[model samples]
Target: MRSFPVRLPSGTRYWTVLDEDLAVVAEADAFLRHVRFGRDQAELTTRTYAGHIALFLRWCARTGRDWRTAAEELGLFVVWLRYGTKEATGADRPSTEAGLVLAGPGAEAVRKPARIENVLTGVRQFLLHGITEKAVPSQVLALLYEVADDRDLPPEARGEGMSYRMKARHRVQVPRAPRDRATDAEIVALFLACRCARDRFIVLLLARGGLRRGAAAGLRRQDVHFMPDSTALGCHVAGSHLHVVRRENPNGAWAKRQPPGSGQPVPVDVLVVRAYDQYVLERMERPHARDSDFVLVNPQELTDLHLRFEERGGSSTPLGRPTAS
Candidate 1:
């Protein structure tokens, strides 16, 4: 309900509060800071971990139980996480009706199984951190580790994805969808929806080259090699290719799981190269273009033709992949 602001290295701020008057517990706060500044984790990772841990802390506070001594309560915690408390259930109701509900009709929105699993993972990590700190009791850890029988597992939870050692003590039954290839009509509709050559090129890089949005967004002009025998970079790839590197740009794009040195090279189809050429020659040289190394730049025109226009990298607005229905 209320938040205490925490600033990130990236100059972005996020609040760390469980409820109106309840900030994250000291142990949880220590774990969060260790993950943030100590391990140098990204802002997103820190926020996610803090949020889940805060939720668990809030539940413990409301239930009149210490988080360290309340492993068995997790069984009930999972139910409240997915379905919320029932009127028939003898669980203690919240002191205030205005508090955020985890799940139920009173909840602002529903959470998918994957989302629930992620939250559980964060709590698990928090407990693990406590174990390392020697703060959590071994009995509590063992209790949380207890698993249910195969027969007890719901139909969705019975299959191969279940962990044998861990069992099903604190797991949610997530519905899995069968993977289907995109149809020809779907692919056609995707390309037809693109408004410009830049858009088409970005889509092609994501679809064909298998480049993530961050990788595509971080690309530099020097990374794109259109020449088979170039005097400039000296390497011949026989076709147009782009190298993906881990570089933090002004626009806030970064390649995930990138190694220290040498980037990955991916060859582009001829049509993708044509799109690149069109975007570079016709669109890039427009008076609005900025003098930046980033490959993707968006232009903003000045109302007066005599005035200079503005152009910048696609950092502020992430160029997301076009979904093929």
Candidate 2:
């Protein structure tokens, strides 16, 4: 690379502009464009990450703080963030950053919590990118590796001072996911224990349809449809197929008798419709109750029926499985 002399506000601006590195920058731009187009990331996520990376690059250039020098200046960056407003105190020198004094919760740094937290993570990622590209020093990478998890940082170091800017990281805890959904054996075990006709169908519907309890409860008498293409329907006459639902538009009907929006055809399993149909005629609908459409609730006139249903129980309602386990 040859230095080129140019006139600037600071007199002679001599720069060693390399031709090869321009191609690298162009490639990086193309990669970001590809990420925007090719992936399924939400628009906001893509924008946020891109914006943060841009800020990191700008900061790196302004401070002449490439990855190699970042390790020596890590403490300074932390101090600059904690205090040192440019308008009041002027541009902070590297040496001046070391003895930064944090006063209280009333500090300027505490004002923008979300930006402060995100910037820390963003800068860390930018430094990592430098390491991968072999632009950063090995010492910076080693120090990054040596830092304890933020949650494990010493209480003494955390005592309000420059040390409060501990290694910023997300605290990881052991995940407690939801308990075992009915396993095949559990479903079988439950079904075997039940003698009632409706109860036997319930287990099969749950396993086959993978229906949530709320969706199951939302079923109605009118939801059942025949797939047989038969004119005359007879009771107990088995057909190869049945549709559990023919969903209408949100307004309950469309001009063309289809849903208002474009929707996909989800075929209902035969066992599920058999189950839905059985509940409607036998359990839910008496002669007077037939007017109401809901399969789960009979329309028998009763005050405060809604209140009773609301108070029934949640999905996590204890089933006494703890004793056996």
Candidate 3:
């Protein structure tokens, strides 16, 4: 089974699951479509959910177990998720030939606890959606969740009474690690290593501006307000800031949803402003960039740069084809 990308006539894209025969799995397709359209989730969300669901379905098929029955024995699945090799888990073709070296007791587990937890979360959601569609038995819910009371909750969370909640039965305990941040020296090194003003601006935007790669790439020329006061541009924001508005971008870049009542624009420092100025000056030298409204324009050379960055464990910000003007 595989996760397949689908594009509609209206240019909306999403992901669905395909069976071994390459036919769309109807149940998986319906659930993923609801996740993409009905729940109004990002397209990437559908892609992720589709991949996880496909894995579960493929496992069920290979093991000759019905999906509903597999839910009851999910502990086995968890073991498989942890220690099963790619060939054993049916993620790769089975080999008939003997290997030169055999895996010993010291072989590391296939997946981390956190990754297994994510897979279980997707599978549980898929099963719940199946229940709503009358395709799964209601009894499976008992196997998946346990009822718990709020007796151990804090006073504020108890809410004046003994409320109950359904807790998931299957969960992996993941260890928390300290969040890592780039040092000043590392940031300076990255900035100095950039070959062009555009690359340098991208480095600063990610390091200092606290902008995600997608949000930084999705920025439009109109979103930037560099002056101390921008009343003339009709923006009420006081300082040099960038508005991160959520909309469908041609490059498939999406800003994460902001919290309610927190619509303030992100402020930028003088250094970032200077970097933007330099980038703008360099961008104007390229005749193709003159007609584009987006703040960042990708050229063929930049596309090659993106590949190298990704190979070096850095994420590529650009998602669309190189555009001229």
All candidates' TM-scores?
A: 0.70, 0.31, 0.84
Candidate 2 Cα deviation (angstroms), residue 185: 42
Which should have the higher TM-score, number 1 or number 3?
3
lDDT of 1 by residue, 84-173 (tens): 443312123444653334553565424567877887888887887788888897666776576445665667867675444465357776
**Which candidate comes out best when scored by lDDT?**
3
Q: What tens digits encode model 2's per-residue C-alpha lDDT throughout 1-325? A: 1112223363322121112233223323333333334433223333454454444343444466663456555555554444645432222232435424445666666324456456556556555655666766656766554544434456764545433233433322334567777677887798789665456555665577554443444445444443554235442323433223323222222111223332222345766667656654554433334334544442332213433444675342322211100
Q: What is the lDDT of residue 138 in candidate 2?
A: 57
Candidate 2, residue 221: CA error in Å?
24
Winner by TM-score between candidate 3 and candidate 2: 3
Error of 2 at 201 (Å): 32
Assess each prediction's global lDDT (C-alpha) against the native.
0.64, 0.43, 0.81
Error of 3 at 309 (Å): 28
RMSD of each candidate relative to the true structure: 7.8, 20.9, 7.0
Please list the residue runs of candidate 1 whose C-alpha ends up more than 4 Å from where it truly belongs after superposition: 1-19, 22-26, 36-41, 85-109, 146-168, 229-239, 288-290, 301-325
- Tens-place lDDT per residue, model 3, 179-254, is 9899999999989999989888989988989999878877888899999999899888899998887666777877
**Candidate No. with top TM-score:** 3
